[model samples]
Target: METKIQTGPVSTKAQMQTVPKKKFKVKSLLGYAAFVGPALLFFLVIQILPFLMGLYYSFTSWNGVSSAVEWVGLENYLKIFTNDPAFFNSFIFTTKFMFAAVIISNVIGFAFALMLNAALKTKNVLRTVFFLPNVIGGLLLGFIWQFIFVKGFASLGNMTGLEFFKMPWLGDETTAFWGIVIVFAWQTSGYMMVIYIAALQGVDTSLLEAAKMDGASAWTLLTKIIVPLILPAFTICLFLTISMAFKIFDLNISLTGGGPFNSTQSVAINIYQEAFQNNRYGLGTAKSILFFVVVAIFTTVQVMMTKKREVEA
Candidate 1:
């Protein structure tokens, strides 16, 4: 009995160790929360909340001004599908614009990237010059180009006696479509050039030297060696240009005001008019949700395809 009474608190040390570990875990959690808490809260409040609200609003018949929100179920979506020619026209215009703008911008951008990637004295200056257009605000750029189309080009045409500059740049549907494409490509190409330049710099020079030693032609080197390695850049630039072209608003709005009739109206412009101008808030939200789905599908597919190419590369 006396020996039994001499038994120590056997689990005391183990309990002490566990206390510190629990404290450490709490501290680590606090650290994570300290770093990520504010940003998470801000994102939830700003982006996620609004999106959820829009999703709910899409099913309602609430005009922007009215306090009484009527739940109209799928009526807004039905109207968009059946009765909305303008919206469809806007979508068609946007799709066409996306193709043109993406192709032109990426081509011009890749060309600029190739040109500037080479060692030259004036390369830096030319880089700055090309990139300057991107620095200008879209609305401002649109206005400036609008003036050029109307006044500056007209003056130039008179001076040069060239019919090329004398054509209506933003009047007819075909010309207006091309006009937006030109402005978009000009504004976007420089940015793409910068991206491509960065990718080009990362390429292995030793491989390039070996390719040259193997008697590969310049075109062969570019097409085989250069392009494949920088496929990621193509993916990024194409994605950027596609999305930007699809959602073109400020430039088109300021440049042509969707004009000469709504021939050049973008999906964004149509959504804006439907929601705010026409006060069909529900219908507008529905259109936005639908457009969002379409865009998400496109961008997701593009990213997946590009990622597969990246893995293959």
Candidate 2:
């Protein structure tokens, strides 16, 4: 007569709450610290400490020999802004070189990537050959190219009887500027090509085939489909080229030595001259700090603009 009912335990809101937060285990934290502590310590000591010292020195008037380092407030900065004509010229030359190098390198690199992306018998070999230049240090590459421009060009000119190579490459200002640009492009384009090639390989062949089947022209396909998909590569390549071109030093130094009346001088050369060459470390540090700011601004603007385009794409 009596009916027995069996029922499962009712789940409450408390039972459905999130799992308890992980406890702060000192052992786990110590393990993580053991893994990351060395790199962080080295970075702080090597990079951050020097940077802090440089910041302090920028406002001083230390000749780098005497123990006397007088704080000159903004005097160093003001002098740089007003009295440093050579530095200004160097800045101008560097800016011009940067624009030329960035544009030419990216264009050539992208073209090389496209060409290599095509199925070819010697693609791998060609890729290695193209990238070989980038493996060499800029200083060595500069010295090598310097010889080519000075001796090699003259010899070839004599053999071919061509007036083009006979002209002074590193002697004249305009030619010297273009000479550095040429070298920079030659050295840097291969690196960008590698990046672009990787990006191109990641592109979906199916989408490209479908677009082709829909009667899309090559140009349309490249601009509409390919470029949009691989925009991140463009962003990375542009940033690298811009920074490299801006901070150009060893190449300019070895190739031209900022010679023929400081015509080919770059900001790095200017800073170096002010510091070690001229024994004006404080002023040099000031110039360096300002140069860093300008570079940071330029690169930041470029990345922001390109990233915006990437989002739109």
Best model per lDDT: 2
lDDT per residue (tens digit) for residues 247-312 in model 2: 999999999999889999999999999999899999999999999999999999999999999999
User: Which ranges in model 2 have alpha carbons more than 4 Å from their true place?
Assistant: 1-28
Clashing pairs in 2: none
Where does candidate 1 stray beyond 4 Å? 1-17
lDDT against true structure, model 2: 0.94
TM-score of each: 0.94, 0.91
- The C-alpha RMSD in Å for every predicted model, in order, reads 2.7, 4.9
Which 10 consecutive positions of candidate 1 have the poorest summed lDDT? 1-10
> What is residue 229's positional error in candidate 1, in angstroms?
1.3
Encode model 1's per-residue lDDT on 95-209: one tens digit a residue. Answer: 9999888988999999999999999899999999999999999999999999999999899999999998998998988988899999999999999999999999999999999
Clashes of each: 0, 0
Q: Quick one: best TM-score, which candidate?
A: 1
Q: Model 1 Cα displacement at 231 (Å)?
A: 1.7
